[model samples]
Target: MKLTLQILTLTSILLPLSYPIEFNYPSVFNFGDSNSDTGELIAGMGDHLDPPYGMIYFKTPSGRFCDGRLLVDLLMDAMDLPFLNAYLDSLGLPNFRKGCNFAAAASKILPATASDLSPFSFGIQVSQFLRFKVRALDLLAKGRKYEKYLPLQDYFEKGLYMFDIGQNDLAGAFYSKTLDQVLASIPKILEEFETGLKRLYDQGARNFWVHNTGPLGCLAQNVAKFGTDPLKLDELGCVSAHNQAARFFNLQLHALCKKLQSSFAGSNVTYVDIFSIKSNLIANYSRYGFEQPITACCGVGGPPLNYDSRIACGQTKVLDGSSVTATACNDSTEYVNWDGIHYTEAANQYVSSQILTGKYSDPPFADKMPFLLPIKF
Candidate 1:
């Protein structure tokens, strides 16, 4: 059967029931870039990302870059919480009960080095969360009791704080600088990340899930832009040099997590190995029912993979004096990539399943003090 968003949502809801009693976090607070953004970019900036972008599931542009739910959405659904609302949504903060997403499309980890595509940085997202906490506490102090909302005392300490950043940092660096230059910047980038984590730790956040950078070499965008030579490409058609950069970053991040675990007493700081999980998926695409592993499901104006960096998905423009509109594949499920940069809904489902399994997580999710049980989707 085709894996649609509805099916994925249903799977998320039902999967947790069979697991043993586990750490049921009161809420989830996420910070990252487009990968975890629900609608913050569209809500805050009013970017015109029109039709076909969200046609697969939402049937309308929901500010998500992909065709359906992101890993964060599925993660929340697995915990039986409503998908988080973008903190900047015009509808207002109706539900802090489940938590709010501070993620924005194109956001970077460092404000100083952010590209034009990413105006908001990780620091900005965390600042917004801090402001939200103040308001939530103020409202509670005013004796305004809202249903499903937790008291300020339990809310600050018990929430799950998630970070899925650093992709844009590397992307920006690699595109503008050399591989050696990007490698040199990894330590400073990780230091900025550690600063953000420390800020949250000081603010009473005890449960932390930090997702490492994925295998950027396998992305259709990187392959199209950097994998021109056969020797530079891997067996899976991914850029070998780019994947090496990703590995270096992940290794540094894992070591940082170890340091964080020691620094934050009684806190659960876990490093999620998204790079390994995604790399394995691309290497073994057939096992995951994916026919096209490296090519984008939606793109235009190119050879080999048909991806055009100038033309975005769901867009039409004059290329070489001829109008070209980016088009999607007949079956999105058959392709792992959505639009050269993002993953398809089906691929995200598989990745999310692995994340919840406690397999890729450092210190293992189930082994944590709160005892998170594995989800069986």
Candidate 2:
């Protein structure tokens, strides 16, 4: 009952805070899925992408798969922090930057779930975060003007750690070589997440913007590509099983957060209800000026689809380049989703506005989200 009340109270508070507010987040260290990927995965994993992805931002794929700036880039600009650098981009310890996102294109909450994901698993992502931190410290000890390069601690004692994932865990798995043994692997995957959280807490990571999963079954990709029917389904479509799995993971995630807060004493945990925010975004895309809410903007098939689903980014595929296997929608900004599985930059902006403005951080996933409400506080 207490939990329910707390969630309700938080939700009420967020509803009003939806409008823009003045808030500054210094040095955001992102983790989790592709929602905040930026370009880390494409840069590190040879299996990831390169040029065509970033054409939106830098006229070439700086590893980003967008036609313009990403949510992180906007946040960085809002906070006055330099854009997040890919850890792999540094090439050496001396080039370390305070903000190097470790988010992969297909990262998951748990290691077990991520094993099937490409190079950027949760464990690997955490490691990369640590590695960058270690390297940052090395630069600090070297008496370099690290603060000038990546400033944040002076304004905010609580650094931002954005963790978003769980979507790919199910999607990638279903698409990958069959996983007849997946359902049994849930517990272990949850454990991996717990383990990583402990490590992060020990390393002085307090502020977290951990996102829950969104509606998976509703994605255009899942419906159009995975459905047996030939005439692909529209935005108002999805898979019940996949969405159920996402809900299950989120439940475990919240329980884990509660357990971690108690087990590892003296830690502040804020869990943001990204699942609800995203689901609502899709459900109410029309309210947000989105003409199409289910499909992607780069592919060909139809709503909730992508340019090409079979091949990983940057990797060429063998399909008849003309097949309607998948497609991209037009006017990404008009849609709540960029790809079936990911939200567009505009969507990210609105969600960020809601959370950062003290709108929903106290209820669910925002429970783990830092009180980024005050630009000064």
Candidate 3:
């Protein structure tokens, strides 16, 4: 009898603890621009996205700038969540159980980028999220049929809030203003970001994942636009000046993240270093199975790289009186860049892997408290 009891205890101890685990938040609320946008811009505005954009994966335009999925899509996949639907996508209204994407292509963190056509700035996106929360709360209070979809209480407080913005803001400042002016605007930009975070905190958001800007200089579009002299180019054929600016922005952002962590006692804020990951990819493309790191997979003109500033991806234009269409490469998986600005699905996949590896994220997500599960193992 003693031997049998010992055997049973050993069996129980040796058994693997495998069961379903719920995330801290039932849903993940994402906010950003083109980098994370699923289809918010397309739904809000018209269909600027055309063929060749999603040819590699979806076989049709899914309103993404890349040839396939964005980093956010890959992240969702890692989380075992469904692809987030754009909040503006009327057709996807029924699928908000997981969460909604509030990102808009070409939108900036600053209000200056807002126009009549593309008015969905970062601020506006946050406002929309606020409105969503309010409506969900109202439905729950009324004892409506939303309990199956929306969390009745503490949803916002529990949900993961991610931000992948600041690219457009820096781009706009760099192009429209002088270098010094652009540098000067960093504080203001960060200030707005801080304000947004505070607003979310006020509304019960505690978990935040913020991705810093990537190496802007290495983008084929930026290289084509700014890399005029060989001396200005890095070894990887990227504009060094633009990259410096990006680094500067990232440094300030890191400091800001630290400040936020201290200010918000209970909040879990993580700063993701996307710049380093992307830079490493550019430096060692072969390691990541990328044949072309500097050139775009879909573009029209090039001596250094095939990227036309005026003619965007999936568009035909008469350049030098010769009709040329921005075409996709035979294999997008071999290339790092899809268009001039966005990354290929493969590149995004690699980057997303790195992001989730807990190497680049501050305080590593795995080390954080796991989401509570009702069913205890």
Candidate 4:
């Protein structure tokens, strides 16, 4: 009996050890907007440096807009990869051996204006990647001591290329164009995205993970800005027109992903349905222990939204001849929206959990992905 028990214990340990590896992506090259900006925006524009931004995890502003890690950070943890350093980060020589992030806050597929915080468009980011590739390869060829900090040539072909932009492209249009006009503009925006993707493919990227835009109407900023008219509100108190636009954009984006998969031979292009996952989270916030679903945890004004365009998070601005500072809530964990526009770290963590489940992805992650680290609240 003792010999049999020892054999069973040994088998159990070996069985887990022999589990087959599935998605063994060597590196992840991320391209997106504010949703995945680790510190690129701060590096580029020198903004978002304030208290309450990285309070939960970093204990100080770490250039990320959230109180803790973003969706990209959580995904990296699950993949057993180090958090991606921003490509533009000039601070203390950033290591790029694993991967690099080209995402920037306020960036979009289309070109940005001079006044824009991140003038780096999707094309610009692609160009930056091209530049980085050349420079890093040169350093490695020279046998520089810092070559260890750069990615090998094969990593580009084997790495997973991730994208999570386009929300801002849709949101910005609402300010200047009618709903129909905004809907009409999606094809052009996606076409630009296609051009960038093709450029990357030419440079030899194979695995792709693309996230569609979320429910724009449900955002605290939009609810505060466009939800004044009761007729515009949907069943969930979100702007009906904005959500409609978002869904249309997502549908087109999904179709584009399908087209790209067929177009790029041997490329595994996976489109993740971020809209449904985020919508479900907002609709069922209470179930997930979130109280303020459509309210900003760190913004001005009160009640339904607590967001003010005049004053940013952690900024003191004069309103009605009096100064008011946009401070954080007592507990950020109970809120979904962080600074009217961005999501809280707690909310990002929840979204990451749902994504890893694979149900929200088109063609589903399923058994293909193995978690290296479990998500924590």
Off by over 4 Å in 3: 1-23, 92-94, 113-117, 368-377
Ranking by TM-score: 4, 1, 3, 2
Question: If scored against the real structure, what TM-score would every candidate get?
Answer: 0.92, 0.75, 0.89, 0.92
Q: Where is model 2 more than 4 Å wrong at Cα?
A: 1-26, 46-59, 78-80, 91-98, 110-117, 145-147, 150-157, 175-184, 229-235, 302-308, 311-330, 363-377
Candidate 2 vs candidate 3: the TM-score winner is 3
Q: What is the lDDT of candidate 3?
A: 0.81
TM-score of model 2 (CA atoms): 0.75
Please give the CA lDDT of all the candidate structures: 0.81, 0.60, 0.81, 0.86
After superposition, the stretches of candidate 4 with alpha carbons farther than 4 Å from their true spots are: 1-19, 372-377
Backbone clash tally (model 3):
1
lDDT tens per residue, model 2, 285-321: 7765667666666555443355346643334445764
**lDDT, model 1:** 0.81
Candidate 1 lDDT, 1-377, residue by residue in tens: 35443455565555444344466677889999999999898888877686678877788878899988788887776676788888888574457677888999888887744236767788889899989888777777767565356335576789899899998888777778988989999999888888888888998999888999898888888888888888999888888878888889989999999999999988988889999889888889886667888888889854458699999998899999999999888888888899999998788887887787777888887543231244346
For model 1, what is the error of residue 329's alpha carbon versus the real structure, in angstroms, after optimal superposition? 1.3
Candidate 4 per-residue C-alpha lDDT over 276-358 given as tens digits, one digit per residue, 9 for 90 to 100: 98899899988777888889999888878999999888888899999899999988888889998899878887788678777
Candidate of highest TM-score: 4
Q: Candidate 4, TM-score vs. the true structure?
A: 0.92
Ten residues in sequence with the least summed lDDT for candidate 3: 368-377
RMSD to native, candidate 2: 7.8
